[model samples]
Target: MWVDLVVEEILREAPSHRHVVNDAKTPSGHIHVGALRGVLLHDCVTRGLRDAGADVEYIYGFDDYDPMDDLPVYLPRDYERYLGVPFCNVPAPEGGGESYARYYAQEFIDVFTRLGATPGVYWTSDLYRSGRFNEAIRIALDRAQEIREIDREIRGSRGLEGRYPLHVICQQCGRIGTTAVVAWDGREVEYECRPDLVRWAQGCGHRGRTAPFDGHAKLPYRVEWAAKWFVLGVTVEGAGKDHFTRGGTHDVASAFCTRIFGARVPHPIPYEFFLYGGKKMSSSRAVGAFARDLAEAMRPELLRFLMVRPHPRKQIDFDPAGDTIPRLYDEYDRAAEAAQGEAEDRDLARTFYFSRVAGDPPRGFRPRFSKVAFLIQMPTVDARRVLERDKGAPYTAEDERELEQRISDARRWLERFALPPARFTLQAELPEAARALTDAQRQFLRRLAEIVQAEAWEGEPLHTRIHELKEEMGLTPREAFGAIYLIVLGKDSGPQAGWFLATLDREFVMRRLREASAAPASAGE
Candidate 1:
């Protein structure tokens, strides 16, 4: 629904409905999951435009021509020498023939591709080397003074008084980050590679004059950002909110777009950050989960739902260590139900529609993710059979596939990120904590053991009986459930106690309950 509103705005503002929606990233390291937010956001707008009968071309660029200014902590210390070199020129970490940028960039490309975002992929290095940016580079060089004035006016920056708006790769050291273009002649530029120019990389102090076109030089990012809009004909683009700040890079770039490049500024779609555990993620710093890993660990639709469900301006704070994954799956299922006309919420239906990678939302028995998670952890339980029974029908082929995918996702979550209480292992012997239970709690467990042994009980019926016994014994929910969990799981809480106990071996349940109930109560109790 937000995407539809954005599409309406873009269509109303642009007389020419044809648009190029673009997003790009510099692959300095393993791209974090946070970067996927921009990619998916752009993709959503692209799809929205197309659905609204506007011609749209979505382009994703890898800004590999950018220099590596910092060594990622995961890399060997010796990689420090590679800092300041253009990423396209550095060797891949695995010693393959691919450039360092392509190696990491391809890894991220695979992730977005899996999410069904197949944009026109391009490399910034190729654009430069192929002379696509030659004209823009010349424009920047010719208007260097004006560009300087714009930066000064907008950002109050005074550092570019004498320096031009370009940097050349040092002829001697091959490092781009430390070189500065001092003068731009009609055909050639004078530059210097100063050793002390930056703290991250040492320069060779090389000086040379060369043509500043055709990959020999690069415009500073602010100018390049505007140049990209001009060269690629991008009409719609968005960046993180930080860039759209007052007097920020986007402001300076917008000024350049209107003044220096003589091009209309692209429609802006400013978005918020995708935080992990409340902290913003970084690509080079290894601060959050890598995009590819998260993609693999989640169902494709569920991952898409996680990205597109929230408004672009709203921050998504995800912590897989808790119930985040299960809850997300639950929400995604609800949206799917709405999409299937099972609910009257149009917004939820729209969310489910856009979250889909392909085809109509499947219609069938959909189990709750939390239940699926619980069932998978029980070694003796047949999760598929249990779910089929709960559905009151045999699983259709589609239902089977869906259950299998959720099972895989649930197991991965359990292995990597599930919280302690969500994880379970039936105690081989009576847990020592059972001795701390109150007498009334033990009495409740003893009654539960009798009910479990009296006759065969399914998950729901057993669950109801557990609640009845808790009331009969005058025990609180915490005490009643705590007694069962303490004996079986050695924890204070777990999945629904009835369903959990019913899934276990009836003999083991009776035996653990007997042992726990018969144990002497703690002194305080």
Candidate 2:
């Protein structure tokens, strides 16, 4: 399994240090399908590692404590009373949960659970409150000199030099720019922020200058993160592509772990964004048509199958149309049929889709009735006549009941969950022959009705009827028997017509047939 590959890589690189997947948050916001993809990827890795005989731990961190300018004071103006509080400490729904840090963390966790991904959560505020991970933060800060040198070495070795800042995080305050200089063991290091760097927000009427860039400001953030992973000792983690962009927190964490706390960087798998209606998935906006939305419309298994293929890096374009769902399932079925003797990748893909489809029927799987043939079977037609005429067995009451319930449920599920029901309607007109007098199609329909009216219904009698009709009409068994489908459904085929008609109320079916037979042909002819 790929998890084994990751574990082997980690063990080879750092045999003594524990392995962990560092799951971090991008500010608390709406959960998107893209985020769900990250969760699934992480699950794959975690499951893979355990299968490979390696111990794995999961650590999901809330970066809510990180400084965020993107948020505004949505609450009443006197918000300073909330300062020094973590993001979770903020207010409820109205404030974007930005009133406190704890509130921010819980909101997204709720969203994640809805998508079927749960992580071992460690809040940054809890770390600060407990003051337990402080030692790791202090050590990483004390070694800021060495960490910077290593960073510079790595950058220079790669023949690229960029402006890199030297700073340590403050455990007391959550800021990253504390610059107080403290010397220990013949090494000079910054233990706090540079008061000189404090400046007012550009063009803002707010008078107070910003706090200086202090190392202590970040101590709380880094120590809490590094310490959580160190103790949890996780093996795999996944994140959205947002955090991996060129220079991001991953780099900072790498330096903190390798140079400071001396732990191995866990395998980081970055996933591409999941688009909704061709746009990047966004939590704050409408969910549009993604996995969760689709799950509501179809079966859970179908949604899972949707993500089974296409590597993590590959992009997906999904449509909510019911037609697309069946096609996708067909593809999944094809993969399953061809899975034997195929490569492991192919087998896994098949297994993945199979499990997803088998998991839960979305809203409820419905038959593909939108097709012209399916429409034809919707009415009560000469199905019995066709069956008797063609020597097919008649249907038992139980069989009839079951088939009727299936059809009714299918129609209901489609009506309830399908988007824009009008789009799937087939309103085209029938041919003049089918519309005017008894088309050969109508004749067969009438034949089935007669047999239903004549005998005690049973599977055998229906089969016998279809066979008889096939012989008399000189039509292939399929061609001869298909007329019943056309007569009942106003189309060429549908759920086995004889069985369908038997299950359905006879009067309803007869009335529908009368209506269909008398109806005039439309432009669709």
Candidate 3:
């Protein structure tokens, strides 16, 4: 519903021509997961507009002509020599068939495809090579003074008066940023590749005069962003919150669009960036969690849900270092339940629809994932029965399939990401710790054996009995549960002992408890 509001507003001021939703990124290296947010956001808007009977297209642009400004940590130090070279023209980091830009771009694209953001992809290099940007290029060159004046008036910066707005890829080294255009004759430009022009890479220091066509030169970022809007007719786009800040990229690009290219700027969807490990994600892959890292850690649908569930303005402080994936699953299932029935919480209901991967989401009496997570590790607790009871309805085939998938996910997630406190295996024998139990602790297990055999099935009633036993034995809940956990799990604590015992093959639980109570209480003492 919120996405509809965002989309309707876009269609309200929708382009008279083809409705286009566009986003751009330069694949300097392994892209941070933060980048996927824009892909999913635009995808949501695209789906919403199509549902409303508006024709729309989503395209992701790769600014492949942009120079490699920094060496990603994953690449060798010798690769730093390629810095300041046009990314599309540079060789892949490992010397693959794909150019350097395409190599990283393909990796990132595969990641978003897994997360379900499949936008039509375009390369900015192709635009320049095809001469599609020539008109905009000539306009920017001819009206350079106008842009200079606007910059001076708006931000009080000295403008590009004598110099051209384009950076020519060097004739020798093929580096873009190190070249400076000193003169523009309206049809061609004369440039000098000064060795000291940039700190990143040394220029060949060659002076050359050439026609700026067929990807020989590219517009500066501010001009390029504006030119793409008119050339490609992008109707809606978004920028990270940093870009939308005071006098940032969005401000400069928007102004350049109106002043130089004379094009309407795309509708802006400004979003906050994701922080990794409490630090702002750096473009450098060494700093933040990457798209592939998170994609493999959990189901992609949950990751996509994370992207769309939050308002664009809200900050998603996702640190999936511990039980965060389990918690995320819990939150997604909550939203999934809210998607069905009259969920008074509107955000919950709307997010589930946006979070789904394909087809209509299975509805009605959805199980709470947190509870299922706890129940799943219990070997004997009929997981389907626990899930069905939680769902309060018999599962259809689809529901059964969904449950099995989640069970596998929960198991994998616990073994991988969750902390030791949340993980366990049902024991085959009374654990070594069972021998150390005091007489009173052994008596507690004996009493729990009776409770388990009485068919006082858990989860709720079993959970209640543990407290009753605590009161009856004059023992702390910790002491009482510790005895049971040691007997079954070889630990001082584990999942709720009562539900756990009831879920076990009743014979296994009864036998384990009997073995534990039969052990010499003073053996370890």
Best by lDDT: 1
lDDT of 1 by residue, 378-407 (tens): 888899888998899888999987887788
The C-alpha stretches of model 1 lying farther than 4 A from their native spots are: 362-364, 428-437, 453-456, 505-516, 519-525
> How high a TM-score does candidate 3 get?
0.91
Estimate the overall C-alpha local distance difference test score of candidate 1.
0.88
**For this target, which candidate reaches the highest TM-score against the unseen true structure?**
1
> Considering lDDT, which of the candidate structures 1 and 3 is the better prediction for this target?
1
Off by over 4 Å in 2: 1-19, 71-85, 94-118, 145-234, 245-252, 282-302, 321-324, 327-350, 353-525
Task: Give Cα-based local distance difference scores for all models.
Answer: 0.88, 0.49, 0.81
Candidate 3 lDDT by residue in tens digits, 1-525: 669789768767753446899998998888888888888899888888877888789999999999988887788898877878988988887667579889889989998887778899999999999999999988888888887776666656664555777889999888898888888887789998989877888888999998888889999888899999989988899888988877777888889898778899999999987777677776555887888888877777798888888889888888876768767877887787677755466778878878776667755344556557778777666778767876677788878777776777777777677776678776787777676788898888888888878856656787788789889999987789888888778888777676666676777878888888875755446
lDDT of 3 at 522: 54
